[model samples]
Structures are given as structure tokens and as C-alpha cells.
Target: MTHEITDELQGIKVLVTGGAGFIGSNLCEFLLNNNAIVHCLDNFATGHRENISSFLNHPNFTLFTGDIRNLTDCKNAVSSMDYVLHQAALGSVPRSINDPITTNEVNVSGFLNMLTATRDEGVKRFVYAASSSTYGDSTTLPKEEDIIGKPLSPYAITKYVNELYANIFHKVYGVDTIGLRYFNVFGRKQDPNGAYAAVIPKFVKQLIDHQSPVINGDGSFSRDFTYIDNVIEMNVKAMLSIHPDAANNVYNVAYGERTTLIELLGILKEELAQYDTAIKDIEIQFGPERVGDVPHSLASIDKAKSLLGYAPVFDIKKGLQASVDWYWEHLK
Candidate 1:
């Protein structure tokens, strides 16, 4: 669903970093549909060309093949933009654990470069893709913005650093900034064939192939699996929000509910079974629990709703059905 002020985005100049990846591509499409001049800066390091191929020729869409780790690239991308949606970063806790140096360079150093550029360029607002991983070891049932535990992974550390930098930029440099702490977001363009692919898309692909999907632990661990549309709505609102308290703050972007892995797997089977009945018969295998993984994650969206007028339209079941439909058509 479109935000109330989405029409305000018309004629707006916006830059979406990592705009060729799943979430960033979705943002690029939505912003373009609303008549925004969208510049996409992605290194193609993790993002795919196929994701933005449909929009490559859109009159309002411009693609800049660049890396955020490079200061010059970051400055060029943010130049003359009304708003900056910084979504570029190295994700995956396991990947970070394996290679902390690269993660820090991309997530932390790159983030600082973007912040510095946005501040210097005088972009109206800077909204970024923060992670729920920043919540880290906290056992809080519904994660609030202020309550956070020590980071459990290098990736979490990097994301947290982003929030700190954003806050500092606003305080020290008068930069308008907002950080969206995204939970486990999933949707159509999400890659399902990577070593560090999100669990939902990855599992759906395995089940579609009639292979058993592996679950770490006993499948009791859960997360606040956010949908892409919800995320888009949040981004738009954060970019356009005029509420005094909305800027220079962090907000949790989630569905405000939790779903266990077992429950998620069950729903996936049911949705995919409509297209291929054999998916229901595929067994689920259990493996050792992943390191740097928390047992459960739930978000408190009260802050976003009150501050940015944020409302999530799609819940898990509906979102899963939509995702399954896309994957079934594309993957088959």
C-alpha cells in the first residue's frame, strides 16, 4: 500500500544505494512509479543486473555502477539528490564471522562515507537500512530502539556503528538522518541460490526442488519476518516525514509479531503445495544451530507508527503467498 505522502515524492531526486539488490530494487521501482528521479548506485558485488533490468530503460531511472567503499563514488551518487536511501552493505552474520575485515569496510567505512557525503552535499534527508541484528543478545520480547544488548556478530557491530554515525552526523553536522532497523525482510526479488541467502527464500527453493530443507536447531528459533512492501512504506515515510521527532532517530521496521521457523516452514509448504503437491511431502532436516544467531526476535513498531505514521499492510501468511507465487513462476 502506498503511503499518504507518497505523492510528495513526485519530481523528487532520490538515490538508492545497492539499488540492484532485492530490497533496494523494490525501493527503486516504487520511487520511480511515484515519479521520482531515481539514481541507483550499486557495485554489482552482491546485487544482480537482472533485478533492475526492467527499469534500466525507464526515463526517470539512472544506474551508477559504483562501490560505496569508495568515497568518490559515494559523493557522486549523493550529489544533487533530495534524499538518500543508503541500503548498500555486506550482510550475513556468518559471512561477517568468516571475514570481519570486509564487512567492517563495507558496512562501517562505507556507511561513514555515505554519511559524510550526504552531510556535505546537503541532502534533505538520509534514510538507511539498519538491521535488527543490532538488537543482538538482548532477550527483550519486543525489541525497542533504546534497548539493545552487545552485538553478537561483526555484522551487528557494523550496523550499530551506522546508527551511531547517523546520530553523530545529525548532532555534529546538522545532517537529517533516520535509521530503519529492518528485521528479516523477504519478497519476490530475494536471491534464493546463495550460500548466505535468507532462510525463507532459500528454504522455499529447496522445497520446490523436492529436497529436504535444513533447519538449524529444532526449528523453534523464530524471527520477525518483515515483508518488502512494509519496508518500502517505511522508507517512503521516513524520507518524507516532517514530524519533529522522526529525524535523527532509529526505528524498528517490522511486522510487530514473531513466527517460529517451524511455523514458517509449515506455511511455506502449504503455499507451495498449491503449485506442486509434492512439496508437502518433503522432509525437514535438522542441523547444528548457527553461530551468532539469537533464539528469537520480535519488534516493537510503536515508535515508527507514532513517529512516522508507519503501518504495515501485509502480514506473514499473505506476504508468503505473494512471495511463493513469484518464486513458483520464476523458479519453475
Candidate 2:
């Protein structure tokens, strides 16, 4: 799927919260490349300076080092911006479970701050990063946007609350908003060294180092592992979309296919073998299932397709191959 760069995006000022993190940093780079004046706001709590270091000197890029929890900072960042891409939030389920108060402060309270700032600033569109975890406890194979079940974890609850808030803000305050419930997004610049690191990046790093990767369960669990570029495309589409039904709504951002954990590991090993044959011989370990983990997850992206014209360009195999190549060259 090819995304056309529109002239309206050029010279437009946009604020990307969490702009130093994985998906947010990718958005910043893509927007800057399209001649957009990009302002990056991050607290560096989970985001890193290294991710934005390369583009720090770009003439169109500006970095605002501040926490979203502070209303003043949120107002400062949202000022004079045409659009707000709110991506700053505590991400991991385990982290949120262990520290619910801090998670609520950042994800819930900080989100409220951004929404208030955006409304006051009269931003054109407020696009945010929602999560697939919001579909917790649902046994549906291909989860749809409207069929979400009760949230199973603190992180899930926070994200679901974001959807509710975005809807209220749109109806009462007339703040135009869109939410993209992202699936398991992974790719280049994604940190693979943290305790809450995503499975794909962590496994890729371990494979590169010829170390064993421990699967959380019996390897039967599956996910609609989305690629970063596909996610970037959705955000851009959401920003540019002017369709009446596109605003004040949520859409699933994913590849729309499921891959089991065992399948994922096999593909990773196959792709990494091109760099070093020995990587294929690395042992795999099994561990107990993680708490708050759902057995399977898949997304129905028909809404995004029909409303925003979203078309994911990479499938699991293609995306995994690209990600593996990136880790091999960068981490090896």
C-alpha cells in the first residue's frame, strides 16, 4: 500500500507525544521527511534520547523535554500545533500491574492533560495510540472495534478509558479525535533490552547473540503482530482523513492475521540464518504463562480500510524478515 504525501501536511505544525519512543519516533521521522514542522514531547521515562538523536538537528524537528503529567507542559507542547499525535503512556501489562498508581498517573491523568490542552489549543485533529489489549477477556478470533470485552489488566483499563474520554471530548467539547488500537507493533529503533521489552525484538536480540529465548507459554498463543511502517501509515491517514465518519472514532491498526509464538520463533530463526548459520541452532526454553495474558489475539481492520482507506503493506513473514535484518546489522 503506497501512501501519497499531501501538500497540506507540508509546513503544518504537529505535536507527537512520546516522540522519542518506538512508534512515536517513527511518526516524527516520517512527518519530518514530508516537510512537516514536527515538535516532539517526551519525558524519557520509557523513551530514549538515542532514538531522536539523529533528527535533533533537522531544521523541521524540535524536541520538548517534558512530562505529560504536568498540565503546563501539555499546554506548552500543544500550543500552536495543527494536530496532536498523543502516544505517551505506560505500555506494558506487567509494569502496570506492578505499579498501577504510576500507570494511572501517566496513562489516565496525562492523557486527560493532553486532551484538555488539545481542546483549548483548538488542534485540528487529535490522533492517539490505543492498544489491542483493550480487547481483553474476549475469545473472538478476529476482534472487531465494537466488540471489545471487559479489560483484564490495568494497562488495558487505562487504554479503554482513553477511548471513552476521546468520545466524550468529541461530543461535548467538539474536539476532533481518532484512536488507533495498535496490535503488537515491532520494527527498527524498538528497544530490545528492557525488562518489559516486546517479544519480537527481545527474541531477535537473543537470536543475534546466540542465546536461548524463553517463550512465556506452550507456544500456542498467537497475535496479530503488526509492523511499525503499517502503524505509521495509519497515523498519517488518520491525520489527513477528512471523512465525516473518520473522526471521533477508533480503528484497529494491524496486519489482520495471526501467528503463533512457535511460528514466530521459527520464522525469526530462518531469517537470521542468512546472517549467521549458527543462529539457527540456538535452543528455545519454555516458561509458565504470564499473568494477564490472553490465549490469542487477532484484529478485524475493515473499519480502518473502509473509513480511513488503511492498507497494511507488510505481512508477518515480510515484516519479521525486515526486523530481523535490522537487528542483525545494528545489534550484531
Candidate 3:
């Protein structure tokens, strides 16, 4: 039914929670483009209707506008799926800090509901969005799958809990799953507006509008900002993979290159300048370091690479180009 990974998901019924968000929307599109039937669930808390409006009429697509924090919604969404890509958690470190309780409800409790449903349904494999934040306070560069540090914020703890619960589910309930520790992902369908918007899109929007973008903490802190296409590829591979050694494991999904935020801003400005050189005038304001944020985050993707045969198609430069062009087209 699907195109690219038809060999893996032909006739498979998949459930993608938070399917209306940026990453989820792209994932839904990828699945439909490949021929898999996708059931998308989102409360529109952060997702936009226009994101999935294009697919409402598709025969293979179904929409459930419900909060993942609601256990009933989680149960209903996973009822008839072969694989569950649980991507519905509340994001943003700032957002979590603002309302850690709400973040806990959606990210932790909501995640357990999905995991329970996955176990109850006995799905072949469940793959969910793990975050680079799980690396937490680790001083090590190029974070590996096994090494980790104490979580700095509620959001980090929640994502880290996803892995913990998944492991427990495997040992206690025999539910096999995969957790993808996504690095900073940016691309098309990413929202550029709102208080909690990601760095790339937010900065791109500001530059497009000739507004000065804020650089948190001198921008010396860098991250392994991954592209959306790479994240999508990892999800696809995770679902299709039948590797015995890869099941119930967490893999870092990234391009393995560290770029500072200052450097990232330069690229965003340069890329936006392609459409309008006036963007070059966009200045940056350095502010106090954000609370509950890591100084740097870079992932060692060898686990995903050697096992899942994952090969990233875009690095930061190419990724920023795609993301900038997309925002310029849609938001601007």
C-alpha cells in the first residue's frame, strides 16, 4: 500500500499519535506516500488543522482529535494498528519549565497509556519519539546509547522515562519496542509561530520578517541538529527492521555533526537571504542562558547506523535550506 518501505509496511495498519504536529505530519505523509494506512491522533494543542487538512479525505487516513493524556483516546487510537509511533508528548524545555505538571501529564502519564495499549494490542513493534534531552547532564560529547546523565528538567525526565518504561514493558510484559532519541529536528511542516517554537523555525521567521533573532547564552553551546528527513528515515527503518539485535533498543537519530547556535543562526540568515538579501540585516540578541537547558547536545548515532543501516540524507546546511525555504513559502 505504501511506496518507499512497501516491502516492510505493505498492508500494515499504523497509528501515529501527535500525527498532526510537525514531525508527525511529515511521518503521516511519508507513510501515506508509501501506501500504509495511518490513523492520526492529536488534540490540536500544538498541532494545526492545516497540517493534516490535506489528508482528511484520503481513504487510508483517519483523524482523531483527542488528547493523548486521555487514556481513552490512547486506547482507541491503538486498537487496530500494527505499529504505533508514539509522538504525542508536549515539547520544548521552556514549555516544560513553565508548566511541568501539564508536561508530566502528557509526556509521562500519556506515554504509559500508549505503552499499555501497545502491549494490550500485541503490536509487532512500537516505535516512539525519544529525545536528545535524555542525554541530560552528560558531559560527554557524542552521546552513546548506554551512557546518560541525570535529567535537568521535567521534559528530559519524561523522555528518559519513555525509555525506562519501554524497557520495563519488554522485561515485564514482553512488548518489543524502539525508542528514537531524536536530535534537534527541523524541516517542512514545522510551525514558526508561538511562544514555544523551535530555534530554527523561530529564527527563520524572525529573519524573514527582518526581526532580530535572540541567541540564548552567547550561542557557544552547540547541538547535533538533525534534519526532519533523517528523523523520518529512522522511524521508517525502525518499523521495518527485523533485526534481532535491534529490538527494544534506543538509537540516536542524527547526522553526527555538532554546530553551535551562533553558527546555526548564520546559516539561517544566509539561507533566508537567498529569497531576500534584506534578511542579512536581521541582527541577533544574546540573552541569559535558558533555564533547565543543556550547554550542548551531540549524539553518537553508531547504534542506529550499524544496526538499522540508517544513512542520513541531509546535514545541517542542507536541512536548514529545506526548513528555511519551507517557512519562507508557508509562514512568510
Give the whole-model CA lDDT for all candidates, comma-separated: 0.94, 0.93, 0.89
Angstrom error of the Cα, residue 178, model 1: value is 0.2
Expressed as tens digits, the lDDT of each residue in 1-332 for candidate 2 is 23658575789999999999998998898888789999999999999998899999999898999999999999998889999999999999999999999999999999999999999999999999999999999898799999988898999999999999999999999999999999999998899998999999999999888899999999999999999989989998998898888898899999999999999999999999998999889989999999999899999999999999998999999898888878888897
Q: Which stretches in model 1 have alpha-carbon errors above 4 Å?
A: 1-6
Q: What tens digits encode model 3's per-residue C-alpha lDDT throughout 1-332?
A: 11266666667899999999999999998898878999999999998889898989999999988887778888888888999998898999999999999999999999998999889988888899999899888899889999999999999998999899999999999998999998988888888889999888888878877889988899999989988889889998898887879889999999999999999988987888889998887778999999988998888888999899998889899888877777888875
Model 2 Cα shift for residue 109 (angstroms): 0.1
lDDT of 1 at 85: 95
The TM-score measured for candidate 1 stands at: 0.98
Provide TM-scores for the models.
0.98, 0.98, 0.97
State the lDDT at 217 in candidate 2. Answer: 93
